[model samples]
Target: MKLSGLKSVENAHDDSIWACAWVPATENRPALLLTGSLDESVRLWRADGLEPFLPSPSTGHCLGVVSVAAHPSGAVAASASLDSFVRVFDVDSNATIGTLEAPPSEVWGMQFDPKGAMLAVAGGSSGAVKLWDTSTFELLATLPVTPPNQQDQQPPPRPASKGSTPGGKFALSVAWSADGRRLACGSMDGTIAVFDVARGKLLHQLDGHFMPVRSLVYSPMDSRVLFSASDDAHVHIYDAEGKSLVGAMAGHASWVLSVDASPDGGAVATGSSDRTVKLWDIKMRAAVQTMGTHGDPVWGVAFRPPGGAGVRAGRLASVSDDRSISLYDYS
Candidate 1:
């Protein structure tokens, strides 16, 4: 696979653009790119021009937008901010569908289930994954990612502390498996927790990094494989089920802030404080292409979802602290 720069929108937002997602295409329109920024607003962009599709910006998000996710159906999308609010709104009409908040539990990463039945959010500092039913707009559960090495579970000297507690975990990012049976979350302390969706229990803890893992994406083609980008400036691949470290690829000069896998699952893309976006070949475990288009730290990168009529070409989008967004044609 190869990536060629297609378009760049300088100062796309007034502040750092921290999140991005590709809203699925609909019968009336092709897929569109959605981005949220530290500027406290979310903007939509078509694949062609970097123009804002909506005449006015969607406001109401206090503080800064931390993450964005589009529902599978393409009718709605959601954005989470540091304020702990998950705002769900229509993709086209831009109407507020619903807003969810698990107070005392700040929000981080979020993704809708493949079937669009539930929305799983990474509970910041809550040390758990919060699930919300799409229809009821009610929280289903807060599945905690408890570490197994608890001292209390053992006899005598017990584990020093229940570092496994959700608060101790300080969850940062989350990703669901292709089949939707498993969920994995990354923490600020560099621990990864894998859980069974049905059983709602912690399965394993995968270890490889020493810094905060800010972004994670499970391979769309392989449910067992997972990719993570961390502040340590490395991208680590893991076998989520086996809890084994598959590989670690490092090149960025600064923190790797965000990562996403291609729909075909052959490659992965990452944004970093190094102010560059790097495309890595998963099988070869190496960086094949590097694009230095942003002068500031890149915060988010998203590959367009594979769908939409007559849309055969591939696209990758990245947003940076330079307050700009860049698009690439991937082939």
Candidate 2:
């Protein structure tokens, strides 16, 4: 229920680290940490020591790597950038598996389905979430995000001018439910779109924040529970199926950039522009501890996924704009 700093990697990247994920262990090796940064490279590190797994960082991404997702099998992973391309590569060999792109639509947040059969990508400006087949790397479907009906807006207010518009719903983040039956995506205008994957239908919209939502993740223990990080400087927990804002937590002094649910489902961790990472106790709905070790905005936080040989204790990681990566023990 608390975090203790274990290892710190100074200057882990030439620029800011925008994303991080733990690649589940395969028969050959233990779980490894994967990071993407503004330096236009993706790097792998040993989870225990933060040592670079490869001789050099993997390169080729342009416009800065912004998001990264590892396959459930841990054999392959994908990294997306502002350049509108998602490069799928082998985890061990780092060889290119396939390149995916939905022309004219930029890629943002991404997550592989629980079964590792599909990849869900937040399609910026396209106003949709794109699903791709993991085996063929071919486009599977696009679920468009529709603006809610005027009456759907609580207390229906008058429209504002162009200058005051909150911008269109450009999908900024995506997360798949535990069962892979549901998927939720966050947008530029602060709306969360929930979809039925099998039917490819937009179920409903979850409303609360009025600013851009940058990150989202489903609770590992509950399919209906969802958490989102937004520019409004708050983390909102929602019941995705019921379309209700179940709870809200506010403590971050600036925009919350990233969020992750702990393996046990008892707590969550968030990174903020306030240059700190906080651990929130889910039952209490409050921040139990704050770690302010980064000098710049903390951009990415990840809970090491459960399950690896003899890996029982919990581990957490945070990457920041200060060009550092820090690991913590959660117990």
Candidate 3:
């Protein structure tokens, strides 16, 4: 499938469009595109023309929105902001369902369980993945990250000349396995920590990128493969279960802010601070098409989830620093 730019809404947001997701269709409406911006608003757009459907702006997020995720059931979606608040809201009614918070820690990326039973938030600077029971909005667990391969004994402290500190860990992005049995989170230091959700134990770390990983997503069809986008301007495909870097796709001239795989698992779309949206052929491990459709840095790009009511053609949505949102036809 190729992408043809359909529409661009300039100044759709006030500041930066940081995150976007597709809200699967309900019985009365087609699938809609949900976008969150640094302006602290979460918006819903009609899928057909990318027009604003519900102007009931979700407010009260004190900081920039960092990530947005829609539950598989089409009833709820969650958003995480720099203020470290995870707001779970109803999709159709535009009502706040729940608000989750963890003190002394900022929030970044987030995802809902495949079965919509839980919400996972990447706890920034907290070195943990926070899970909430969806029904009760109760704190389920905090999965702490373990340092990779350090000897049992603690290492010596660094010299005064060095600026870095010891024992500081920051988590930035998170993904859940399709079966909801496994969870993986990426950190500011470029480490992907895997965990067994059932046991709440650390599994292993997937290492490749040396820069902050901004986004992570698991292929719905193959839970073993994970895609990561980093500030290094490359998308790395990792064997999540095998803990090996399958390959890296690079082309963006600046930080790759967001990366998402097509539901069919054949293509991936990435938004970059370089002011462009790119479509990558996963099998070729290269960018096959580039669309400079946004006037400013593109921060978020998302593929519409499949199997929703009345959903047919593939759809892609992108939000930018230019305060605009762009829609593309992927067919």
Candidate 4:
């Protein structure tokens, strides 16, 4: 498989685009590309031509929008900002569905449950993953990423303490398993905490890189497998349940910022501080192709969810600090 540049938009955002997700298609519309930027706005684009879905950028966030997540049903989505608030809104109308806040904590990355029942946010400094009920938008639970001994302890009280928790696991990015039974969150110290979602407990910790792990994702076709990108400049694949490092792909010259598994489960794509995007073949554990289309560090890369009528071919999208968005044909 290879990636061919199809379309790229210069100045897609006024500032850095930090997050991207493919919103699945509803009965009335095809899937759309959702992006959040340091410009403090969230934008949606047509998957085919990169046309703006909204007349103007959707605004409400402050301190720049850092993360965006689409519900499985495609009717609603969520965006989080550095200001510590998550705005859940209707996809079509941009109507505010709900606003979520966990006092004294910052939001970094977010993902909706596979069944669209819950939304998980990586709670920075709170050292936990916060889950909210999607239906009622109520706070469901907080899964702390502390060590086994401190697992039962609550995160530092409302006004968070200055020092780090015993584990020092400041949650940065989060991903849910395909079966929805497991969840994983990456931390600043490069530790990955896997949790049993149903019990809201940390299952085990995976360690490899020494720097921050900024992004992670469970294989779309395998619940036991997980991939993580880190400031150490390597992408590590893990057998989450086994608590073992299966393999680590090293190629990026700088920090690997983001990673996503292809829908077919055969390959994974990564964006890096090296100003390049790479496609790594899982079976070979090596990069098959690299695209240096962005002039600045690439921040996010995502594969379009497989479903929508007449959309059989694969597509990948990447956003960067250069304020551009690029789409590629993945086949």
Candidate 5:
């Protein structure tokens, strides 16, 4: 699939547009694109022309929004800010549904369970992942990261310096398997850890990136394949079950901030600090097209979810540091 730039809405947001998501179609209206910005607001837009649908302002976020997620049913969405707060709100009514917070760390990225029963937040600098029960908005569990085995038999002695440790795990991004049986989170130190959700045990770690992994997603069609975008300016495809890196796709001139796989798993879209959005053919492991639609860093880009009420073809939305949002027609 390829993308043809459809429309660009300048100043769609007041500050940097940091996150983007799509609310599935409902009987009353087609699917809508939801975006969160450094301006501390979450705005909704019509999918066709990127027109304003609901420009509701979300206050209370002390810092830039880092992530946004939609419930499978399209009734609710959650947004997380750099201040470590997760706000859940009704998608259609824009009513505040729930709020969650954690201490001594920041919340960077998040995703709802496939069944929409729970929410997962990447616990920044906390060396853990936090899960919340959606219905009650209560903190469920904190999954600690396991240290990887060092190649040397005797690893360097733990640093004697204050606040210095052999391994500093800072979770930055997260993803859920297609069946929701597994959860994977990437960290600032370039490691992807997998966990068996039912058992709540650390499974294994996938290694490849030498820099922070900022975004990750599973192929909607295959539960075992995972795609990750990192500050290393490369996308790593992993064999999730085998804990091996199968391929690496590189092209972005700067940090790749976001990535999403197409519903069909035929392609992947990425937004980069290079001020460009790219579409890559996964089979070829190369960027098929690049659209320089944003004047500043592109923070988020997402392919609209499939199987919404009136949506037959695919759509892509991108948000940027320029306080603008762009829409593209995917075919």
Candidate 6:
């Protein structure tokens, strides 16, 4: 797979663009892109011409938007702020549907289940993953973080020790299994925990990264495969169910902030503080293509989902601290 520059929107956001997701195409429209920024706003954009949709989506977020998750139906999506406000809004109308708030538990990463029936949020410093019913927009449960191998109920070693720390790491990123039976969250301390969604139990921890893991994605084709990007400047691929780190790829000189796997599951893309975007072939466990030399750190990267009528060409997007968004063609 290769990535070719398609378009770059300079100053895409007034502040840094920290999160992004692709809203699936509907009958009257092609797929649209959603971006959240530290500017306290979330904007919608059309891939064609890389132009912004008129009317400036929404601007009520208090602090800054940190995470965004799109519902499976493409009718609605949610955005979370540092102030712990999760806003679920209409995609086309920009009308607020539901607002979820829970104090004492800050939001970090969030993702909707495969069926869009549930939403899972990584709670920062709260030591639990918060689940909300999407339809009702009500808090359902808080699953505590506990390492599967906690001897005598003691937490693992501190981070920075090459992941000797077992559990209770600060949750930084979250990803749901393709089947929606399992959920995985990466922590600031570089530990990734897999949880049994059905049983509401801690499954295990996958160890490898020694720094904060900011982004994670499960392969669309395989529920067992997970890809992670971390401050360690490396991307690790793991079998979340097997509880083993199967592959590691390193190329960035600085922290890797975001990672997303291709729809085909043949490759994974990463954005790094080194101001670069890279594509790594999963089977080879090596970076085959590199793009970007932005002036500041790349904060987020996302692959367009494989749906929507006539959406054949592959697309990739990256947002950076430089306040720019870059689009690429992956084929």
**TM-score to true structure, per model:** 0.93, 0.94, 0.92, 0.94, 0.92, 0.93
What is the C-alpha lDDT profile of model 5 across 243-329, one tens digit per residue? 989899999998898999998899999999999999999999999999999988888999888865657878899999899889998
lDDT of 4 by residue, 130-237 (tens): 999998989899888777696566444333221222235678889999999999999876789999989887888899978778899999898999999998899999
Error of 3 at 79 (Å): 1.9
Compose the digit string of candidate 1's lDDT tens values, residues 1-331: 8999999999788888889999999988889999998888999999757788899778868878888999999999999986779999998999999999766445888999888889999887667789999988999888876555662452221111111222256777898899999888987777788989888888988899887788899999999999999888999999998889999999999889999999999999999989999999998999999999999888899999988889998999999888999999999
Off by over 4 Å in 5: 148-167
Question: What is the full ranking by lDDT, best candidate first?
Answer: 4, 2, 1, 6, 5, 3
Score residue 148 of candidate 2 by CA lDDT. Answer: 49
Q: How many collisions between residues are there in candidate 5? A: 0
What is the lDDT, from 0 to 100, of the residue 38 in candidate 1?
Answer: 86
Residue-level lDDT for 63 in candidate 6: 82
Write candidate 6's Cα lDDT for 76-101 as tens digits.
Answer: 89998877799999999999999988
Error of 1 at 11 (Å): 2.0
lDDT of 6 at 104: 42
Task: Give lDDT for model 3.
Answer: 0.82
After TM-score superposition, what is the CA distance of residue 204 in candidate 2 from its true location, in Å? 0.0
* Best prediction by TM-score: 4
Candidate 2 residue pairs that clash: 1-331
Candidate 4 residue spans exceeding 4 A from truth? 150-167
Q: Candidate 2: lDDT of 78?
A: 96
- For all candidates, what are the clash counts? 3, 1, 0, 0, 0, 2
Shift in Å, residue 239, candidate 2: 1.0
